[model samples]
Target: MHRTYSMRQSRAPTASQIENPPPPPSSTKGGRLFGRSNFGHAFRKGTAGAFGPDLAKKLSQLVKMEKNVMRSMELVGRERMEVAQQLSLWGEGCDEDVSDVTDKLGVLIYEIGELEDQFVDRYDQYRVTIKSIRNIEASVQPSRDRKQKITDQIAQLKYKEPNSPRIVVLEQELVRAEAESLVAEAQLSNITREKLKAAFTYQFDALREHCEKTAIIAGYGKHLLELVDDTPVTPGESRPAYDGYEASKAIIQDCEDALTNWVSGHAQVSSKLSTRARTLSQRRKNNASKRGEGVDLAGQDQPMKGDRDSWVAATEHGEIYQHGQDEDEEEEEEEAEGEHEETNGESGGGLSLMQRIGLQSKE
Candidate 1:
């Protein structure tokens, strides 16, 4: 028996190990949790009939929790995308605001320079007035000295005991001339003082206007900075109504501003057209009253929006009848037809000896 006996068989697992399992189902892949095996089939058979009491409820809860977690992650991803988009819009608005501010600042600088030029001109005028006033004041003494010399000459003549009426009249004329000169000197001094005062006042006014304009420019710059810093982010909602509202608002503002500028430019053009029309109408009435002359005058009065000469033939002269123009046009057409017929005959028929002689003479 000891020489050739087979090894004894091992003992099988107990019924307790097969029935109530020590460990739960595995949570890893490639691990048998439910299948046809000694322990696995027993576990499946035990859990098969218990659907809603304990284990199934736990599995349902776990599935629901997994779905909720996946949904939360999706929401987080969408929120990140929305935030990125809003940031991009905010950055774009900031850039556009900065560009607009830069253009406006350039215009403001040009305006300020123009104002400075005006101020300098006014200051120069004021200085000229001051010089004129000093010069007039200096001349007052010379006029007084001339008057005293005239008085002394008159006294000397009277001391000569000249009872002539001619001498007395001459002295009286000299005295009147001296008195007029003094009066003229006083008037000139007053005029010079007024001119100097007015020039200084104008310079001061120009300076104040320039300062106000500069302050306005500065305020615009500050507003530009604020717009850049406070640029708001647009939401990701597909609100066509909101977008349309903003677009319409922008369009309305643009139209209003355009209308203002157009009115200003139109006013200037109207004034110029009025003056030109008055001058040209008088000239046209003085000149020929032909249809072409009236058309030219009307063209000058009512110029086109951009091209001024397009409607030059629309006006009729006061004295030139439409029938006359039609008759003249018909006569010109008849003459053209006769010339064309003569050319056709000359081309079709052989040239005459006179025509050949004339042609040779021309050549």
Candidate 2:
């Protein structure tokens, strides 16, 4: 069989036949088989082949999607960073506000201590005034009792004797005692009013200052609260800060009112005292002027009385000189008149005392 195969062996296949013949395209049931399409093969041979374009397009779309996702992530990260920065800034602001509030609270505590001191001072002043009034009242009682006892003693002494020096002394003592007692009673009443006035003045001043400081503290606290609650960005928005500010302003206004009232009252008191002091000064000046005038009048009267006495002495001396001269002249003339008197005796005997006086006057 091998010899016969050799004998019947066909000529060696050509180079083309040696290779296997190209397989036929497989047939599909209702259409051409899905092998490599001529159009697809031709397209693949060019730069824009169908499968190549589709693959490149898919790759391009995936790259674009990845870039979009990355961009979105980057934007989200930036937004988160901004939010975090805002939160950090807000947190710092909050810390500052808390610190400020703490400081304000400390100041408020100090102010409260000052207010307590003012209250204590006012209470002490009241106590002092009360003590002063009590002392004055006690002093007045003794003075009044002494004056009454002296008056009764004087009346009893009067009944005992009329011309006794004891009665006179007793009356004088009663008068002096009564005058002193009346003065003491009046002064006691005045002291009470003065004590009340002084106490009122002190309390008013202290309370006024206390209220002012309280207002300042309240204002500071309110401002601190406003800072605490303030919004960073929205200036126009209504917030707790605005309400706190308003409340602070109201407190300040109240303080102003209290201060105003206190100042006004103080001014009135000062004015009144000034008026009284001026009146007292004028009265003292008037009294001094009257005393000076009285002294000058007394001095002028003394000089006039001395001058009148001197004039009367001079007139008496002149009359004494005239009388001595007349006596001397009569003695000298006596020798010469002796002879005439012997002849005139007869005529003079008829002349009465009135006629002799008339004759002497003629001579």
Where does model 1 exceed 4 Å of error? 1-103, 122-142, 148-178, 230-363
Q: Quote the positional error of residue 227 for candidate 1 in Å.
A: 3.1
The 0-to-1 C-alpha lDDT of every candidate, in the order given, reads 0.37, 0.39
Q: Per-residue lDDT tens digits of candidate 1, residues 238-311?
A: 32221222232233234223322322112221223587789998888767555343222322232323421111
Tens-place lDDT digits, model 2, residues 1-363: 000000111222222213322122111101111122344223223322122122123322332233233223323433433443343333334444443333334333333443443344443444344434443443344456667787787778677765678877777887887776666555655556877687667556545545555565566556545646544667675434322323433443443344324432333223245888999999999999887753222222212223211211233234432332232234225423434433231110111112211221121
**What is the C-alpha local distance difference test score of candidate 2?**
0.39
TM-score of 1: 0.28
Query: Which candidate achieves the best TM-score against the true structure?
Result: 2
